[model samples]
Target: MRYISTRGDAPALGFEDVLLTGLATDGGLYVPESLPHFSIEEIRSWRGLSYSELAFNVMHPFVDDAIPADDFRAMLEETYKEFAHQAVAPLVQLDTNEWVMELFRGPTLAFKDFALQLLGRLLDYVLEKRKQHVVIMGATSGDTGSAAIEGCRRCEHVDIFILHPHERVSEVQRRQMTTVLGDNIHNIAVRGNFDDCQRMVKESFGDQSFLGGKTQLAAVNSINWARIMAQIVYYFHASLALGGPDRSLAFSVPTGNFGDIFAGYLAKKMGLPISQLVIATNRNDILHRFMSGNRYEQHQLEHTLSPSMDIMVSSNFERLLFDLHGRDGALVKDLLERAQQGPVSIEDYRWRHARKLFDSDAVDDKLTCDTIREVFERNEYLLDPHTAIGVRAARNCRRDPAVPMVTLGTAHPAKFPDAIAESGLSIKPELPVHMADLFEREERCSVLENDLSAVQSFIADHWKHA
Candidate 1:
């Protein structure tokens, strides 16, 4: 399948190319030329297969020509073999009609592991075949950095550098990334918000001279199509376990970058019987406002309990707009430009169209804590702040009594011990083996101002030393 840039300027690329060149040249995200579909019979036939098997089946269409079938299958199997759960993303019924898809079963104890684990394998395979090395630069609000660091820490052919907003992420989040002792992993604490970190990454890509000068740079964020593709497997797994296309399912995703919910959309396009995709947001609710027809306005960032969702700019939403406009890149570019200048008012019809496929709700800190307390009291379930927002949002939109609603549990509660404790729940979850003694480790990272030259210089210096 060919991938095209949302801005219509970059050359169309195949799966591997799209995976490597994350943000398109025209400052847009890449999307598939056309979505591939799967028949209901084909989806149902995958009922009892292992997660790896199911992932191979679901992702084969997208990367059929990019990677050899046997190699891809082997990679998928190897990528997930170390997961704590045999059923990689297990489903637990929270209520008669509600379930929580436990996605923190991988090494990092975050939903990002579902994709980054596979991403590490894919990167190794591709780089080995080409006999090349790459520098992976990513910006993370919280979980993505730790997951990426864990996935690519000691890999010989790839060097990963993650930039996170200083003092914005939670303590555990910071420690997870900072404490990794891998020589190849570099963490930069930027003196700005998540948007600044994200902008720096984008600027690095835009610097043609710098991009061509030294080490090859790729991104591990959801901007990489492979990351989103890998995430789609869980939706299929959850849907199939809950009777699949036979019964419609609704997903409540704790959305920040929009990639997670967009994967659900891809599942629907591929004929999964999903009724609605609910976007659960914290105070940084650009997505919520867009879906609510109050205009797609990006305000100043806010520090919230759910730090991962503390983003003013939702990057993956551009891909959705590209699809929504029927792959008309010109329209996508125009809309994005307008949205950036100010809050572009989405037409009522367009807003309703988006709302048809997805519903949105925002939960503040109080509601998040309340939901955590309530869920713990009623069901003996302990949720992190982000997952608590999702649970509350799901409860607000719980209309269909028959259709099962699945909320994507994005992170393990241990990642946010303070919030979890503040919610009046006491569950001392075991840390992942890698993070067991994070506090004891001394961190090695550069504190950088939000300047492009400084970031560029850091990359240049690192490449030169390597």
Candidate 2:
């Protein structure tokens, strides 16, 4: 399968090239040139397959020519075996036709492990074959940093750097990334919000002359096609478990960067019978505003209880605009540029078409904490702030009561104890057995100014020369 840039200016590439190339040369995300559609019978046949087996079947079309069948199967098996749960991504029912897809059962205790664990291995395999060394640069609000480091720490051919906002993320989230000490794994605490850190990474990728030609730059962010490919599997997994193919399901995703919900969008395009997709957000709600009104604009970033969704700029939204504008790259380019300075909008017909499948709502801090308390009181289940927002949106924006509404549980509650405490619950949420000593672990990290030059220079000086 060939992949083309959303901006339509970059050259088309095969799956392996797309995996490593990440953002296209024209500063656009890559999407498949043609999505492989599965018929109802084809999807129905995959009802009882294991998670790894289902993953292989769903993702094979994208990576078939990149890796041999048996080798790819072996890597997938290895990737998921590290998950703490046997089901990998499991579903827990809350009420009739209402459920939560628990995605934090993996190594790093977040939904990101579903993709990053495999992405690290795929990059290693291709780099080793070509005898090339590369550098991975990513910025995270909370979970992605730890998940990426855990997945790629053992990689043989890459030096990975992850940046998170200093004193902005929860203590547990910061410790998870900082405690994992390795020469190849470097963590930076940027003195700004998540958007500042994300911008630095994007700017560095735009111009990589700082690396001095010794290494190629790679991405672990959702902008990488491979990460999105792995995420598509769980959407299929959850749907099949809840009786899919014949019955339509609805998903409410707590999204910040728009990658996770974008994966759900792709699943629907590939023939999953999804009735509705809800865009759940925290106070920083550019996506929510766009879905409710036609205006797509940026505002001041906010810090809420759910730090993971604290983003002003939704980077992947451009991918959706590329489609909404009938795949006109020039139009997408102009729209995005205009959005930077002020509010930008699309044609009324295009906006109305999007409103058909998508609905959205922005949850504030009080509602987030209240939802967490309410869910725990109703079902004896605790929710992290992010997942609480997802649950709230699923209920508030749900159009039908009969359809199964499954909110994507983004992270483990143990990872965000402050939120649990703020919910007025007396019980303390303990960490998992393996991470029980997380607070006691010695952390090593460097604090850097939010300046792009300082951040880029740090990576250049510390990167292991090829």
Which one wins on lDDT? 2
lDDT of 1 by residue, 46-101 (tens): 99999999999999999978899999999899889978988888887788888899
Where does model 2 exceed 4 Å of error?
none
Off-target runs (Cα >4 Å) in candidate 1 are 426-428, 432-434, 464-466
TM-score of each: 0.97, 0.99
RMSD each, Å: 1.5, 0.9
lDDT assessment of candidate 1: 0.86
**Clashes in each model (backbone N, CA, C under 3 Å)?**
0, 0
| lDDT at position 288, candidate 1 | 90
lDDT of 1 at 18: 82
Model 1 clash tally, residue pairs: 0
